[model samples]
Target: MLDANLSTQLKGYLEKLTQPIELAASLDDGAKSAELESLLQEIASLSGKIAYVRKDDDARKPSFAINRVGSDIGVRFAGIPMGHEFTSLVLALLQVGGHPSKASQDVIEQVRTLRGTGSDGVLRFETYFSLSCQNCPDVVQALNLMSVLNPSIQHVAIDGGLFQQEVEARQVMAVPTVFLNGELFESGRMSLEQIVAKLDTGAADREADKIRHKDSFDVLVVGGGPAGAAAAVYAARKGIRTGVAAERFGGQVLDTMSIENFISVPHTEGPKMAAALEQHVREYDVDIMNLQRAQKLIPAREPGGLIEVQLANGASLKSRTVVVSTGARWRQMNVPGEEQYRNKGVAYCPHCDGPLFKGKRVAVIGGGNSGVEAAIDLAGIVNHVTLIEFDSQLRADDVLQRKLRSLDNVTVITSGQTTEVLGDGHKVNGLVYRDRLGGDSHRIELEGVFVQIGLLPNTEWLKGTLALSPRGEIEIDAYGRTSLPGVFAAGDATTVPYKQIVIAMGEGSKAALSAFDHLIRTSAPVEAAVAA
Candidate 1:
């Protein structure tokens, strides 16, 4: 049904796509020089053609009302679309090109209009990073994907050690600070969701209220979780103008459906813990926005000054210091039923809600350290525990896996794929699966499912605003100062090795102390000004 020439061209494109591009040992490598050059040119041409096809498809795509746009996307673009946030740009361009994606055409068109033509000028982006940071990989990958998506955008990633001079000159405070056209756009862990939201919405204008935008604060906390809550309460009780915001509050603690690890309380739910934290923060007239994500941060112009916190809502808050207590979240499955049962019994933290299913049979779907850990924890209370794994062998740390295997109550289902989650009501009850090697179909009855897959740092909102680790967590000094001054962060957002509520809380307290110290060293004289 296709034209012979077009069909042949399509086949060639497919072949090229299937072939992996040979990367350089160094960017200046010359081993396969000639072949690589030709391949690059061919890739460029193919990309252009693909873009053309996408544009053509966009002409026929369905349109939707504008309000469906997410706030995260709008904030990301206005502040800085760097790091993981850059992935939003790549996806945005793909949407404009009519590539198959979940984003609506209208959103794509808006991005296209904003990006305009980078062809006329060179867009230089430099990110400061290091191998020691676990959160840095996602940032580099996202930015590299953006370059592939848009040829006009030139990107350069520099190791932090190699750029010591430049870092010092720029007050290099972070691992993944991004500069756009030589201007600081963002400098920390920003997510793709926030990036798209920011870009989709036009750049925000500065506020008219000088006090709200420039006045010093009694306490400025960076993160929004348990530790942040504790710090905010302490600071506000001492009569401080307290304000807290993160890409999302409750932190990684929210991903935990239940929490049995915290001392004193035998059990607690994440949402409940978060609600209590929110209530505690609110009790002292503290300014708090749960879903309102931060975009950019800047030190006040006045000496001994305030720090400015910018929000996705286009508003700015002035505080004397900050406390970064944002936490982490569960890693995604990237398989079926993951998104379908997000809040429907498919959970991550057993400490938060393990008691709900006192005798209910459930599946602990993973084989990693977290998986085995969750199985061990759940086996003591749950009716039955099925540890489902897709790998040929379990990869959990030896000791944890040994403990898990020793438990007679835990059953390991290996080399299996959960094709779907079988459920008729609001909650999950069972799963349909396939055995990879045997090529067999099977079903397992379950009352609940806990996915202890992994975790994602909640630093996507800070892309181009601070330094981030390969794991996407914020990079902080021993005292928790981020790449940017007057902007300290802590908890899971930082490059901490282990992610625990107690650790996050401790880091939050440290960040608060540091923020306070910075404030004391820099606070300016207060004037009797009108409340703006």
Candidate 2:
């Protein structure tokens, strides 16, 4: 059943549909058919322009299609579109019911051109997703929009939870795992442009070789997180040529669920914040190169020389100054069975995967702030939470520890080190941990395990090029200046004390100002005189 707020929002969005959107469910004695049927009926009740019907075709059981009154859009969902994927269903209805897609004009044109030699050759997209994955909806929505734009492309989103056999067969270790034409296309969140580019070339590694050129800019900001986006905007405001290179915008922000620490804003969602960041950056004249990953950094041979940045795509960028803001990522325990059961039973983000384990016992691995906080958060959603820590005492704040102690559904275990992840090759069923104080091993039966240890900086790519702290973070001075001249660093990638959105934004501003000062002082007298 739809809630009050969600029902109102869906009704408002559905009002844009000029034509009736028909939802057809194939119910042939499948386990999920009744559930899907109920969901469709509830959705159809939300708006007058929506309708549902039962089809006696030979299509996949429990599958559904969104049609524009009389025509099928070639888009289908082989699993229930609940949880985070509910947005994908709404978007599909809007797009097929005469509402324009949210994708850019270029992406729409690219999808249209994928119709190869008539409709005989079809572009089949199989996206594997979890109900709780926050990033899964983006991938599903993008592929679904492409299918709506071009009839030659057919897209089907498969819930990894429902089809465990297919997931194990395909070895889908992560949510939003996309397979194009029966081949693995990508594994994580990707921009629409990147998806289209990969689909056009039929090769994920082709972009790096195809884009072979040296791009020069006055300031080049690496990473597309909050820090890098702020730096680019600030630099561009000074009327300088600025560019940004990132594998994906939003960085860890995309994984974050509800953000309350950000100043001025009391609360916000991760995707909303990420969209706002991208929108703010676009307001400036910054050249954003999404899906472009920075590979190597070559410092200037001499003073006033150009610093070269090599990309994984084989493209090079030269800039007078560079700002490194590649944020940190979740650190894995690297124990046995960890990799094998990544998405099966082992998950890094508690916010994104917590809902999937509702009413089921789960374990949070760690005793630190993140771990304890995760336990406290999961206590309300799950049936029970087992909190394990490697240290004798919890490293979380007193307030968090007190809050954790107040929860009845949480069990705390100290001096416990994760030994192995327990899974049945298809899904995680339990885990093994060792007692550090006593030479004994213990096991806990849980449906899911959330790794909440700490974060690892995204600075491995700058190993020999820049000075790093013992913890592998970039070392920087107060002005956000790194060890290298004409270079600066900020955000979680650097040795900053705190890792918050507001802190990262301030550091980024500082780094941009420092770089601008360096440029003013290092410029030739003739060029400086012209400005004077």
Q: Cα lDDT of all candidates, in order?
A: 0.58, 0.84
lDDT of 2 by residue, 1-532 (tens): 6788988898889899988788888876765888888888988998888889888563556778888787657478878888888888888888988898756676688788885433578878899887877788888988888888888888899887777667667766567788877887787776678678866875345545544453577788999999998899888888788888887898889888779989889998788799899999999878887888888999999997788888886678888999999999999999999998887778887765665566779999988888998999889888999999999999999999999999999999999999999987788889999999987999899888999998999988899999999999999999999999989988999999989988998998889888888888886422322363
- Considering every candidate listed, which one attains the maximal TM-score? 2
lDDT of 1 by residue, 1-532 (tens): 2346744554454343322222111212333333323433333344432211111111111110001022111101211223333343334334323344443354334433445235765445556554333233345444543444443444555554433456556644444556766777675544433444454454223212322454446676756777787777766655556766655556655445457888788887665577577666777867664445666777657755666777766777776666666566667766676666654566655543354455678888789877888888889878899998889988999999888888888889999877877666556778877999999989989867777777777677678777888888888899888887777777766797777787777777677667656655665322311121
Worst 10 residues of 1 by lDDT: 59-68
**lDDT top scorer:** 2
Candidate 2 has a TM-score of 0.85
* lDDT for 306 (candidate 2): 80
Q: After superposition, how far is residue 390 of candidate 2 from its true place, in Å?
A: 1.1
lDDT measured at residue 388 in model 1 versus the true structure, 0 to 100: 89
